[model samples]
Target: MVFVESELGLHSELESVNAVKILIAGGFGVGKTTLVTTISEIAPLRTEEQLSALSASVDDLTGVESKTTTTVALDFGRITLSSELVLYLFGTPGQDRFWFMWKELSVGALGAVVLIDTRRLEECFSAVDYFESRHIPFIIGVNCFDGADVYDEDEIRAALDLSEQVEIRYCDVRDRESAKQILISLMEYLVAGANSGV
Candidate 1:
C-alpha cells in the first residue's frame, strides 16, 4: 500500500504513491473512449464534439464513419488494480492532424495500446510508427468492426509488418469483457518485458 506521512492526521493511501501512466492511442473512431470507460474506476473524462462539416474531409468516414462525436483532446481516467497499483489511463485524440500532441501525451508513459480498425488498417501505421520510433512498448489491438473481413493473428502480424516481439490481437471495443481482456494482455506484456529488462 502507498503511504505518506501527513501533518493532517487523517491519513489516506495514495497520499504519496506514483501512478503508472498508460496511453490508449489509435486513429479516428477506434473505440479508445469505450475501452477507457469500461475499465476505469472513475468516470472517464473526454473532450468530445459533434462532427462538423469540416470534419468529413479529415476524419475517416468508412466504418464508424457515421460516428457523430469524436474525442478532440485527451481522455483521462484512473483504475486502481491493487492497493499499490494505481494506473492513469490517457486516451489520445485520434485524428492524424493532432499528431503534434503525441509526444507530449507519451511523456513518462509506461507503455501504450494502439487500437486499430480492421477496415482501415493502414490508418494505424502512424501510431505504430510513433511508438516504435520512441521505443515505447505497446500492443496493437485490431478493433473488429461489423462487416469487416476477419484476419487471423498471423495474417495481421504479416500485414502490419510487426516484428516477432510485438504483441498483436483482435478485440471488440463495445464488449466490456473483450476490452478488459485486451488491457490485461497489455499489462502482462509490459510486466514480462520489464522482468526481462527489455
Candidate 2:
C-alpha cells in the first residue's frame, strides 16, 4: 500500500496503482539481472545458481567464460515510476535450456528491453526474433562493457537487421541512471506506437 499526500495536507491511501509489465531479455550473460537490480526500488528476486558440470554441455560460455552463475528461472523487480504508475520488471533466463519460460514471463508484458553485448551480438539474435515475431514493442540496449568494441547505433541496427521503427541505444547496465533511461526509452516507444496505431 502507498499513501499520497494531497494539497489539502491529507493523506489518501492508494490501494491499487497502475502496473506496467516490462520484460528484460537477452542472451546469456547479457546483464539482464544487473539492469533489474540497478533500477528496482526493492530487493530484487533472483533465481540464480552456480554453473554446474551438467550445464557444461548445454550452456555456451563464449564471451562469458568468467561468469560463474546464471539465472536459472527468472529475475523479478519493481520500480515506482510515479505516484500512480509502477513498472514491474521480469528478466528471462538467458540459457537456451530455460527459454521455455520466456513465453510464460511475457504473457502480460507491455514491452521489452533486449540487452546486447557487443562482443556477443549474435547471441541476442534469438531474443530479437522472439519479440518481433510476437509483435511486442521492444528496444535494444547495447550494454557497453569495460573493453568491448563500441559501435554506432546505426551500425548496431544494421547488424541486427532491425527496422527503422525500432529503438536502439547504448547503455551501461551497471549504472542505475543508464538502466533507468533504457526503461524510459521503452515506455516512450510504447507510447509512440500506441499513439500512431502501429
Candidate 3:
C-alpha cells in the first residue's frame, strides 16, 4: 500500500492507496500494446518500429503477416483502478531478440497477464515457462480473434501445461471493459494468494 498527498484533504477519511506494478506479456502480435492502450488513463508510450525487410527472416509472420509494426522495446501505461489503488502496466516486446528486456521489465512486477492468440498458442510457451520458473503469479487471457477457434479453460490449461491453481479467462483486448477485467482478475488473484499464505 502507498499513501499520496491529496489536495482534497480526504486522507483522514480514506485509507492509504496501493500502487502495483503489472506486466502484460505474450508472443508476437498477441495484442499486448492494444491491451495497454485500451485501458490506460493517459496516452500510452510505445516503442514500436516498422518491420524491416532485412529482418524478415528473423521475425516470423505466419499468422500476422499484415502487421506492419513491431514493438522494439516496451510499452508503458497506467490506470487508477480505484480510489485506493492504481496499477502501472508494462508491456514486453514479443520478439525473441527483445526477450533480454523482459528480465528488466519484470522486476518488481506484482503479476502478469499472458495474452494469447489461439492461432499460435505455441508462441507463448517461453513466456509461460519464464513466469512459472520465477514463481510469479499469472493468468492467461485468450484474445478471441475473429474466426479463431475457441477452447475451454481446462483445455487451454492442459495445452499450456499450467497447474490448476493458475486461472485462464477469455478476453477481447480491443474492448476497454474487457481489458480492465483482466487487470481486476489479476489483482483479485494476488489478494487471494496473500490471504491464503500461498
Candidate 4:
C-alpha cells in the first residue's frame, strides 16, 4: 500500500487499509490541541468555543491561571504516519466533569497519548489513574514549558508512582517532530505489549 502524496490540491492513490482512531487526552491546559495540530497532515478540526465569564469561575485553574478557554466537547484532527498507517486523533476535553463523555470518545481507540504539563503535574494523576483502572494502554508525554525545571524520567515515574509497565517520556507540543515521535513511541509500546502477551 505504499504510495506518495504530492502536488498542491489533492489525490487518492488506491491502497489497502491503513487508518485507526487514536485518542489525545489529558488534563486542562496540558497542550492536547497543540500536539494534535502539530502532527496532523490536514488542518486540524478544533471545536474551540469561547470561554464565558460564568464558565470560567467553575473550571479549575490551579496551576494554569493563564489559560482562558476550555475544550467544551471534543477536538478532532488527522495525521498520516505512512502510506500504510494513518491516524485519526480525537482530542478529549480535559476537565473532570467531562469524564462521562470520555468513554464514548475513547471507544475503539487503538491507544491514547496523555500529555502532561510539568508545571501542573498533579492534574495528571486522575487521568493516569483512570486509564490504569480501565486497563487502557497509554503513554505519557511530558510537555516542557519555558522556565520549568527539567525532571528526570525516573524522578517523574517515582513522583507519579506509575507502575513499571507504563511508558513515560518528554516532548515539546509545539515541535512537530517531537509530537510525531511520541505517537510512534506509543504505537511501538502497544506492539511490544501485544507481543509480550499483555
Candidate 5:
C-alpha cells in the first residue's frame, strides 16, 4: 500500500488513485494483444475475429503467416503498477482498416508503447507516427520472436527514427515477467518525464 503524510504528520494509506490510460500499438501481428494478456491482472477483453480469405486483400500478413486471428477493435486489460497507480491498457487493432479506432482508443492516454516485430519493421511506422503526431510520450518495445532476425538497439532506434532519449527494451510478450518489465520501464520513463517536466 502507498502511504501519504497528512498535515498532522500522520501516515495514512491512499484510498483513491487516478487510473492512467496506456495504448499498446503496433503493426499487424505485432503481439499487442498477447502483451496485454500476459501482464493484465484480470482476464483480458479481446475483440478478435478469425481471419478469412477475404481478409487477404485488406490485411497484410507478410511475415505473420501463422496468425489466424486479428484484433478487430481493441483489447482491454487492467494492471496495478503500484499501490498509488493503476493502469488501464488499451491495445489498438493493427490493421489499417481499423485505424479509425486508434484515435478513439488513444483519448486521454498518458502514453503508448509501440510494439515492434523485427521481421515486419515497416509495418509499425504508422503506429509510431500516430503517437508522434499527437505529441504523446511513448517508447518502443522490441517484441523479440523466435526465429526472427536479431537487430541491435542502435539499429532499431535508427530504423524507427527515434531520438536517443526514447528508451527501448527487448522483450517477448508471451513471457509475463519480460513483458511486465517493459511496462515498468514505461512507467519509470513517464515518472522521469513528469519529474523533469519534459
Candidate 6:
C-alpha cells in the first residue's frame, strides 16, 4: 500500500526544508573558524594547518601574534534554526594564497558575515570589496578580541567606506550567543533585502 504524505511523515519534512547557505568570512587570524565552531550543532570541519616558519613571510601575524593554526581552505558547520529553517555555515580562509577557494565556497551562498578584528581594520578591505563588488548581501561582524581597542559602528563604517545600508554588528566570536546573534543579524538583513526585492 502506498503511504500518504502525512502517513509517511514527509509532509512536515518537505515543507520545513528551508536551508540557507551563508559564508563566515574575514581577514587572516580573524575568527571565522571560531564563529563556526561556536554555533554549529555538529563538530565543525576545519581545514587548518599549523603555522610554520616556512610560510612566515606569506602569512602576517600582526594583531593575532599567537595564532598557531591557519585555515588553509575552508571551515564547515551547520546549525538548525528551527523545523522550518536551517543554516549551513561556510568559513572562508583568510590568507591571500587561500582566497582562490572563496569562489568555490561562495557558489551557493545566499549571504555572508564579514568578521573583522578592530586591530587590523585594513585586513578586511579585500573581503568587504569582494562581497560588495559582487552585490552579495553581507553584514560586518566586528569580533571583539580581548585587549583590542573598541570602535563605534559609525567609525568602522566610515573607515571601511561602507554604505549606510550595510549592517554592522559587534560580537565575541568565541561566545556562542554572540556568534549566533551575528548570524541572526545577517538573516534579518537578508530577509529584509528579499522582502524589498533588492
**Candidate No. with top lDDT:** 2
1-198 in candidate 1: lDDT tens per residue? 222222223347556555789999988888898888887767789888999999888776887756999888888887665555677899998897777888899999999999988788887888899999999999998888888899888888888899988898688878877876787788889999999999
Candidate 1 error regions (>4 Å): 1-12, 15-18
Clashing pairs in 2: none
- The C-alpha TM-scores of every prediction are 0.89, 0.92, 0.92, 0.90, 0.91, 0.92
lDDT of each: 0.83, 0.90, 0.90, 0.81, 0.88, 0.89
Worst 10 residues of 5 by lDDT: 1-10
Better structure of 3 and 5 per lDDT: 3
Writing each residue's lDDT as its tens digit, candidate 4 over 72-126 gives 7888887766666677899888888777878899888888888888778887888
- Model 1 steric clash pairs: none
What digit string (tens of lDDT, one per residue) describes model 2 on residues 1-198? 232332122245345567899999999999999999998887999999999898878888988899999999999998877667788999999878898999999999999999999999998999999999999999999999999999998899999999999999889999988998899899889999999999
TM-score of 3: 0.92
Regions of candidate 5 where Cα sits further than 4 Å from its true position:
1-15
For model 6, what is the alpha-carbon lDDT of residue 66?
87
lDDT of 6 by residue, 53-135 (tens): 98788888877888999999899998877666778999999988888999999898999999999999988999999999888
Q: On residues 1-198, what C-alpha lDDT tens digit does candidate 3 reach at each position?
A: 222333224666445767789999999999999999998887999999999997788889999999999999999998876666778899999989999999999999999999999999988999999999999999999999988999999889989999998989899999988898888889899999989998
For model 2, the superposed segments whose C-alpha errors exceed 4 Å read 1-16
Give the higher-lDDT candidate: 2 or 3: 2
* Sort by lDDT, top down from the best: 2, 3, 6, 5, 1, 4
